[model samples]
Target chain A: GENVGLHLPTLSVQEGDNSIINCAYSNSASDYFIWYKQESGKGPQFIIDIRSNMDKRQGQRVTVLLNKTVKHLSLQIAATQPGDSAVYFCAEISDSSYKLIFGSGTRLLVRP
Target chain B: GAGVSQSPSNKVTEKGKDVELRCDPISGHTALYWYRQRLGQGLEFLIYFQGNSAPDKSGLPSDRFSAERTGESVSTLTIQRTQQEDSAVYLCASSRRPSGNSPLHFGNGTRLTVT
Candidate 1:
């Protein structure tokens, strides 16, 4: 079975500080990894993604790091804001499968 | 361009009853997927449809759950003899294609509450 798990269920951070959410995946064949943000009463939104070939990828204010050797993935948010408070999930997909396997999710709470 | 659309933002059905949830993917997208999310839980893949190929239903929880897609436009997920444990949010997502490189865009989801 393919399992993707997060190290922490909930992470609280102060505004203007950096936040890092960690995820561990069991499938080494997973070639693509993605980070998603889901707010209350909304669907999960794509934040950033990193391919197996790349160790890191960056977006507007977010960065995704993939360590294929350890089968670990991470999402880093710069200057965390109150609006960034949401549930974050890391998903992985292998070349053999079309579906994405998602982790349980980490709740990000930012204090003003 | 409009994003993926799901109907019946919320559904409440009694146990033993059946319910149908709908999804309309983005016009040009050729892939659609259905997932379930329990309270404070992650997305659980249920089914996937791509182009004209047979849908991948390996993720479906049981025989009580089934889904259908007409071409690449619309999809419907049906649950039979729903149980209280079936209460969850049914989310629909779509991608331009089935490739791993394509990112899936999601819909708000239909929150199903089975009593």
Candidate 2:
């Protein structure tokens, strides 16, 4: 079965450092990808997204890079902060369907 | 503007009991979705509603689970004869347009514990 998965279960980073989260997806048909952040006791919040045609997209202090050739996706956060600590998930969707398939999350722990 | 809202932030029910979870999407938003998250796991798509179109329920785990939406307003998810496996956090999200271009706004979600 096709699925999206993360490279690591947990990542510990010190404040003011750059943090990167990696994801691997098996479905070649997926055209849209998104990243979400879920804090404890809260629902996942939309972070950033990228289409298959584009390799990279940037938001406030965050960047999403897509490598379609390797079926890999990565999220980069600059100047990691305490507020950035959360569980991050990557989701993919194909044009033919409305379902957004999510990957197992990576827990980001920003140490002060 | 208010974001998506869900009722009964937490629920504890005994096995075999039925439960209904409610969701109120952002005003004027046309796309709504339901998802389930078990302990320490990513969300699992459950159902989707887009305007007058019939809902896409391909992700529903079983016949025991069902959902209903009125036009583009409130939606309810019903679980009948609930089992322990049904314990999870139910999240609701709304998008202003097709999620292909627009991002989804999610609610706090309802936490269900089946004993």
Residue A42 miss distance in model 2 (angstroms) = 0.6
What tens-digit string does per-residue lDDT give for candidate 1 at B26-110? Answer: 9989989999988878899998899645458888999999989888789999999999999989999999877588889999999
Among the candidates, what TM-score does chain A have in each?
A: 0.91, 0.92
- Model 1 Cα lDDT, one tens digit per residue, A1-112: 1111234388999999999999999798998888999988889999998889999898998989888888899999999999998889999998788889999899898999
TM-score of each: 0.94, 0.93
Runs in model 1 deviating more than 4 A are: A1-8
- Model 2 chain B weakest 10-residue run by lDDT: B51-60
CA error at residue A49 for candidate 2, angstroms:
1.2
Please provide, for model 2 over A81-110, each residue's C-alpha lDDT reduced to its tens digit, 9 standing for 90 to 100. Answer: 999988899999887777788888999999
Cα distance off (Å), candidate 1, residue B68: 0.4
Q: Which residue pairs does candidate 1 place in steric collision? A: none
Q: Report every candidate's CA lDDT.
A: 0.89, 0.89
Off by over 4 Å in 2: A1-8
What lDDT, from 0 to 1, does candidate 1 have? Answer: 0.89
